[model samples]
Target chain A: MRITCPICGERDRREFYYVGDAVALERPDADAPPEAWHGYIHLRDNPCGVTRDLWYHEQGCAAWLVVTRNTATHEVLGVALASDEKGEAR
Target chain B: MVELAPKSPLAGLVPVTVGRMTLTEVDLGRLTSVAPYRGRDEGLSEALKAAHGIAAPEPGRVTGRVAARASGRDEACAIWFGQRMFLLAGADPDPALAQYAALSDQSDGWACARIQGRGATQVLARLTPIDLRPAAFRRGHTARTELQHMAASITRLGEDDYLILVFRALAGTLVQDVRQAMQGVAARGGG
Candidate 1:
């Protein structure tokens, strides 16, 4: 698979560093249970559909990006910089 | 400088040594060997947190030292980041490799890059809000933040020091963006 970084241009899939889902999660309060902090920091739902995720071009300029992809196919639905709050990712 | 290996990927821009062999390049001279990089893709957040560190005898306004451990050439510079290794070299850098520094703010380490050369400063000035002046990001310090179109952290190794940070997803375009910015500087100079 291939993805293009707005700053670096076209590159192989290997160049990127995947961050997980971007759908906002709730934060646990300071006195919250220990499991809450662990879940928020280290857990993922691992859904298998169109999902919004965060990725970085670790090999390039290291831009933060929001990517839409299909987990089952490894096919990227769309890509955009995290800075782009409202652009069509595809 | 000694002769170069015929099959080096960076046969033109710089002559550096990787592992135990001196490689060739088109622009720079043949020099020492450098190492390859493997990015933090799987379990990155954890590794990143580990890499970020602090600086002791803080770098002044404009000072830095060359880190030439494994890489053969006079390229890579070893930055003092508390207890981390920050390598910077455009000659033949593999962005895929780990390039990070620990932060005082968060557990996650920030990714960074050392982009040097004459036009490097001017190139960054075009996309960032921070002053490129020596006073703003002097030699030994590192700053984590976002710029123009990306979320990144930058550091100053010297006058041209830049520890540009962005998500690994956008790593591919870093060189070109800076290149285009440099081109702008060149054009302005010509004009």
Candidate 2:
């Protein structure tokens, strides 16, 4: 698979280190209940359709990216820098 | 008293030639990694231009020269290394640059090599996954990618000349990998 890095353009998948689930970014507050922390740390939906995940361009630009892809078709729908996504989330 | 002499990583290795291609070690002089502070990209570019006569290069590109010899004023160049980072090679960086960016000395951290001549692209093709076609990766284009499982920075300096930089500790491996690729290409009568 090829990932198009915003800064470095397109690169092979081998250049990236996959970090499962973009939802990992939404960390629960330190004072949150045990169930919330447990869900954040161990539980996953593991959906079969469209999924968003994190990927680090370890051997390339070293940028964290959020890749929106379809698990069924393996088609990459979109990609954005994680920093940019956080800024927009705010 | 004992005198300490600076030795290159590839101290005893000589340049290798296969077919029409040659792989030679290069001394990039003082290497400095420049990372502009947040929202200071413009300031850093201006400071670099004023101090070194070159601006921060665009992503995947390089500005200035990569000289064959480290001597002379024309040896300095700014190569875009990764996101928001540039490698200032072949000359000493100006102290004034510090106000706009973080400068870290990397003079001895990397070993550089130049691969040139016909079929140079083929030699690299065997090692890297990036597209090396001249139309896609023109002169001054650079990429931080894997070179046969080793992290490497590759820059195209001329039509058939490329500059490769890898960790200093992997100098021998880099040479060995490139030599084997060179031989493979030559054996196929590609060069």
Candidate 3:
């Protein structure tokens, strides 16, 4: 699979490291209850269809990318820099 | 007291020529990595221009002369290394740049080699996954990618010339890998 890195353009999958979900960005506040923190840290939905995840461009631009892709077909829908996405999230 | 001497990473390695391609160690003097602080890109660019007469290059591009002269400080170049990072090579960086960017001396951390000749692309194609076709990667284009499992910075200096940089410790490995590819290209009559 090829990932289009926002800074480095399209690169082979070998250059990227798959970090688990984009949900990792939504961290619970420090004052949150243990259950809330536990769920945030341990629970993840393994959807078969379209999903948003994080990918690190380890060998290219070193940019963390939020990649939207289909797990069933392995089709990449879109890619954006995590920094840009975090700004939009705010 | 013990005397110390500086030796080049590829000191004992001679330039290799295979078919139309030649791989030679290039002396890229005073490599400095410059990373602009947040919201300081323009400020850094302006400072770089005033001091070195070169501007910070856009993503995947290079600015100024990539060639090195024996005169030491006559030529310099800025190669966009990665996201918001640039490598100033072939000249000493001016102190003024530090006001807008984080400057780190990288002269002893990396080794550079030049691949020049008619078949340079063909030889590189065997090692890297990046598309080296002139239409895709034009002159002044650069990429930080894997050169046969080793992290390297590859830049196009001309139509048939490329500059490859790797960690100083891996200089021997880089030459070996490139030489093998050159030999392969030559054997296939592609070079």
Candidate 4:
């Protein structure tokens, strides 16, 4: 897989590390019930179609990225900087 | 009182040469990293320009100062690491920028080396998975990438000249990897 970093341009996948689902960034309420906290920390949906994931360019650019990809085919649908709330990418 | 002499990270390793290429460590003076707080990048740039008489370059690019450093013939340069981040060598941090940015001294954290020769790009291509063609990765272009599993920053200074920076702890490993890659390029050229 190849990831085109917004700042560093295209680079090999080995330079990046998979950071799991992008949704994890939104933290659940701290005062919520025990079951709600458990679900937020340990449970995740296994989507088959398009999925949004977070990736860190550990060895390239050092920028966090949001990668939309197809689970079945492993095709990358899109990529964006995780810091960019507007979802802009080059 | 005791006096101490500064030693380069590669002080013990002999400079490597393969074909016409040479890899030698360069001791940089007053290296600093500047990072602006959120939404303060524009102000930081202006402050740097006003104080240092130069503007920071955009990401993936490098700009050189008009004056050369006392230790080297090459003009002093600043490399852009990423958004709101820059690495300046041969220049001191602007005290005026403290209001807009955070500054850190990086002179000892990184080890820099200059690579030059007829086949310098070929050897670099073998180590880094980047399209190093002259047209695509033109002069002044810079990138932070992985080399032999170690993080590195590469800046193209000229057609055959490049400045590579790696962590000080991994300097030996990086040089060793470059030596082996250069040998491969030389062997191919000789054959």
All candidates: interface RMSD: 11.9, 0.6, 0.7, 1.3
Give the per-residue lDDT digits (tens) of candidate 4, residues B1-191.
Answer: 88999888777764788889988877667788888888888898787777766677788887664124423754446788765688877777778888888889998998888888789988898888878998889887888887777788888877877888899999889889999988999999931
Select the stronger candidate by lDDT from 2 and 4: 2
True contacts kept of 1: 0.00
- Consecutive 10-residue window with the lowest summed lDDT within model 4 chain A: A81-90
List DockQ for all candidates.
Answer: 0.04, 0.90, 0.85, 0.73
Candidate 1 TM-score, true structure as reference: 0.34
Candidate 3 chain B lowest-lDDT run of ten: B65-74
Residue pairs with backbone atoms closer than 3 Å in model 4 (clashes): none
TM-score (0 to 1) of chain B, per candidate? 0.44, 0.95, 0.94, 0.91
lDDT of 3 by residue, B1-191 (tens): 99999898778874999998999888888899999999999999998998888999999998987744312446888999988899998778888898899999999998888898887898899889988988999988999999999888999888889989899989989999999999998898878
Every candidate's CA RMSD: 15.2, 1.7, 1.8, 3.0
Candidate 2: where is the Cα deviation over 4 Å? Answer: A87-90, B67-74
Q: Grade the docking of candidate 3.
A: high
lDDT for each residue of candidate 1 in B8-93, tens digit (9 for 90 to 100): 22223233222222212111222112122334323333332233221122211111233121223343332322112233322233
Name the 10 consecutive residues with the lowest summed lDDT in model 4 chain B: B66-75
Going through the candidates in order, what is the number of backbone clashes in each?
Answer: 46, 0, 0, 0
Interface RMSD of 1: 11.9
Model 1: how far is B53 from its true place, Å? 12
lDDT of 1 at B54: 16
Q: Per-residue error at B1 for model 2, in Å?
A: 0.9
